[model samples]
Target: MSAVLLDHHRLQYLHEAVRLGSVRAAAEALDINASVVSRQIALLEKELGLSLIERLSRGIRATEAGALLVERFRKWEADQADTVAKLRELQGLKRGHVDIVLGEGFVSDLMSGPLGRFWLRHPDLTMAFDLAGTNEVVNAVAEDRYHIGLVFNPSADPRIRVATASRQPLCAILPPGHALAGLNRPLRLHELVDHPLGLMHPSYGTRQILAMAEAAERIALAPKLTTSSINVLRHFVKSGLGLTLLPAFSIAADLADGSLAAIPIDNRLLSSSEACVITRRGRELPHAAGQLLRFLSGQMRAFRAGEPAAKMKPRATRR
Candidate 1:
């Protein structure tokens, strides 16, 4: 009947309540009274003439409308932060924050040089890194929750844009004295069948690509160990428990230090896997974030062409 206008304060209350899953939790986060949050959200619902939240047995859940609103509010917050950062840039003030979500496999490469170099060049800029699987990385970037995403063999998504990509094939990681480590040439997928194998969880892009290769080669691989941690997989092999599959760049330090050996896989799909830097399809990143994205694309070992020097060496049997 009457024109309705939403209040920013009320929207914030609703956002926090939905995010934290309870009014009391939201109140604790905001350092306010629970009643205040509930009252404000109720007022927001009244104004919108729609229920924004539904109380569950233990907590609360946002209605579909509320979820949509919350998503918009999050995007609005991100845009506002980006706008302020851009304005600061125009004033020659070098201060901004960038958030990135990436697969664990990229951690070694990112920390080895690219992250440090970027930090040295832009001392005032801050960055946050969250480790996730490829699917989570894609969703975070697409939803504007993160500025950049580093993924391996990411699935095609209309909401994602590949900023840069490099061919970084998945390789079988073997312990120095392991039989597979003595292979002078690329290892075939079927060759790993009899060995104790460790694999990343199916959620990871690495596992997804491996699955495709298995299907293509008409071989089913049943790994003895399945885990979500990349480090765990590395350790699984290092302990001589089993061999695992990962990109050579993922274990560059291990390879260089002779702690592990990575043999290229012969599967066509495995060889075609690429490490990619992605962003939201049409989103304009902040100045600092954009610069970091470009820096990573050019500097990260995973995004660079060719294998690491350790992987290029001739394989030798341990005495």
Candidate 2:
């Protein structure tokens, strides 16, 4: 391959290789031979004057440079799709694609039931999900990352159309053996100041809620553990590390199983808020995004209807 040549195919290969971690697996996905995939990677490395990946015992790993390239190309791929969608939309086509950018929390719960059904009903639409923080969500949509983005506790932004999906109340996640494991009544935020707490990363929506609590009480919480995965945070709480603070819906499974407890925070620290669909100004979504939007809307409605806030009692399912 020529040094100046930039092939989207090569970019796709690198991205897939990174995600699947196996040239053979990636080749299988692309329906090509492993040797062909290896040759393409070699060409890519030669063009960049650096190895993009290394063969691991079980799979492969991207070099730092390779990782950066792959991430950038992910955006590039998205941009190409957007361009195609827009050009068609300009030519008497109101359908092309729908980019449904969402946070990890929404991915876990709101994506499947109703939203998935919506996708099935709309065959002409296509959709993609991007995960990022509030600022990134706003920026990406502003920069046309996807037709729409989901923002948690979204602040004012000129980049995209924002909507409120849900305003959930912050709650405490307690472990099984904890004395407060069975309580469902609202509790004060300051009450948890002394107890060990597990917190999410500063970039996450949950982190913003905790920050508000810290500012209101004029104190900072020194968590025993901090993480990105809400599930892992719940796991730590279940393991007796500490408690966590987030909206009631985020940990519905844990609460139902009695492995964790959700207690409302009465300190008025944060009004629980999370991601919702956002579309850029002057941007018309493709068939996929519109389908996804209706899907997500339905999902959110069903979520509100089926998942209710009830006091959970400690059950035998406690882990």
Candidate lDDT (C-alpha), each: 0.87, 0.68
Clashes within 3 Å, all models in order: 0, 9
| lDDT digits (tens) for residues 226-295 of candidate 2 | 8777777767887877788766566666666666767656565464444456776656556556656655
- For candidate 1, the TM-score is 0.86
- List per-candidate RMSD values in Å: 4.1, 9.0
lDDT of 1: 0.87
Q: Please tell me which predicted candidate would have the highest lDDT against the true structure.
A: 1
Q: What is the lDDT of residue 139 in candidate 2?
A: 71
Local accuracy of candidate 1 as per-residue lDDT tens digits, 121-227:
99989889999998989988887889999999999999899999998878888887777666577777899999999998888999999999899989999999999
Error of 1 at 118 (Å): 2.5
